[model samples]
Target: MTPTRRGPKKIDYVGAQSDGTKLAADLPAAVQVPDDAVAWTAVLGESTVRNLHSPDWKTREHALQAVMRSLGNARWNAERSPEDVWNTVTQLLDKALKDKVAPLYYASLELLSTLVATYSPNLPYGVLTQGLEPLMPTLLHRVGNNNARIQETSIQALLTLANQPALGLAFLAPHALSAIPKKSQSGAAAAIQMSGRLELITCMLNVQVQQQMGFGTAGRTPAAAAAAGKGGDALMAEDVVRFTRPALDMPDDKVRTAAVRLVAEVYRTRKAAGQPFEVEKMVGAGLKPALMQRLA
Candidate 1:
């Protein structure tokens, strides 16, 4: 028999270069920073910023990211003027607002957050009042996104906006207020109360009472109010009293415990502010025996 023709031995291809450089090779090119980037003269030249909004997604993203990074760097360096960055940022934000793409929407929020953190001095109050106002409704609608990063970023952006009193009030207007309680129930009640979302404050207080009484999550009542800071303390005491009274009456040990915590926080807040303590009276009227025994 002809020397048996053997199939070629399959060589196991382990070699010094086994690690794949192919992925690196296949990666997209790094975005080019135009020579004029970050130059105030070039940035403000007529039609400079407008060109940044061209249909190229990568370009828009690069421009926004570069502007944010430069703003941060300038803030750190203290060498660059803020006015230039502010103008460019506002122009980029305008472009982002006009774009219908989801990525651009999300990027606009990121840019806004950076603007808030870095260039508040240069950013006009009117810009925050008008330009940023419309974005909140859009963001509130996206809070349920399966992307946790997006959800968290949106909440953080809202929180950042709320740090300013005027913007905070604008944010609490009906539409944004409606989104807080829809979050996962685990933190929903606490977040609503802490956010000073008065519309849902009573409901959250009741939940906190339930939790404190061992009916639900424990120790969340005062914790929620404390998280709200002074803004929450300003919520009418009558509302707090109204919500906690039923829990004060419940025979359930956990409910009683929770109610006591809620009432105490209200009274504490009022006392701290040198205001009348009305929550106790409401509790007494609604659950006389329980208040006398538990809260007294």
Candidate 2:
């Protein structure tokens, strides 16, 4: 009788290799996939939380995926208190955001973006604010990460969180205002990082501008009375202009260009919102020359 033939064994899960080289594989199909009704408690199990901080990058990446998948699939409830879950997830993600590995960093940002998108509408404002307070600073710092993908992901994550009612100008403005790099501190690499930070701040301000003008995600213009009723602390145009003033003087063209874009966006946002503050006047005579030099 001919010997029975068998194919190579399939990997249902990733395991450590003998040579210590990381395996480039996705989590196995056998892994439990969370359904639409999965609870946060089940997803944030002990082992899963532990793996999120594992020494192995792949393990951490897989843990991020599990968390993200659960959030994406789970049914969120505004009435259900999410403090415990929020704290646990926030702590893990904070570490993950600081992860040196590029893939893990991006994954962390994706997970964060998912969490904010899923729960912002349902969760209480104070609860979300409490959870994200520590995170916002870390995120602002990560916006300057060396990896381009990480920078972009970090920016997107910040905007996703900020655009929601739970987090707006009141929460984000201070962090953005403080993240500017000193001219002496920014070297060749730092210049690029500075540009990333400027870009992110510009995007965030633009989101606020859109909302203030009643051009929200739905893009329906509300009545004048209702437009002013959109509650939250409006971002001070003067503060942002002052924040970017240093960037206007930086010798690096990229940094200067980003700064110019930021200032321009600030002016445009004010114009669109019909805000009373004169941003150009706020920056004094220097604003025009800076704009002209760049335009020239």
Q: Please, what are the lDDT tens digits per residue for candidate 1 over residues 1-296? A: 67976532111111121111232244344322234334533543333342343345545555566666766664443654455556555645643543444565566678788776666534445554445544544455344443455556656666565444333322333334343342322343343222222223334334333433456322223432333342332235675566555545545454466557766776765565577764446665545664666555
Model 1, runs deviating above 4 Å: 1-51, 73-91, 94-106, 121-124, 164-175, 178-296
On lDDT, the leading prediction is 2
Question: 205, model 2: CA deviation in Å?
Answer: 2.6
TM-score of 2: 0.70
TM-score per candidate, in order? Answer: 0.41, 0.70
lDDT of 2 by residue, 33-113 (tens): 223213434537756754654556688789889878766553633333466556657766655665656677677778887
Off by over 4 Å in 2: 1-43, 72-81, 181-184, 217-233, 272-280, 285-296
Q: How badly does each model clash, as a count of residue pairs?
A: 4, 0
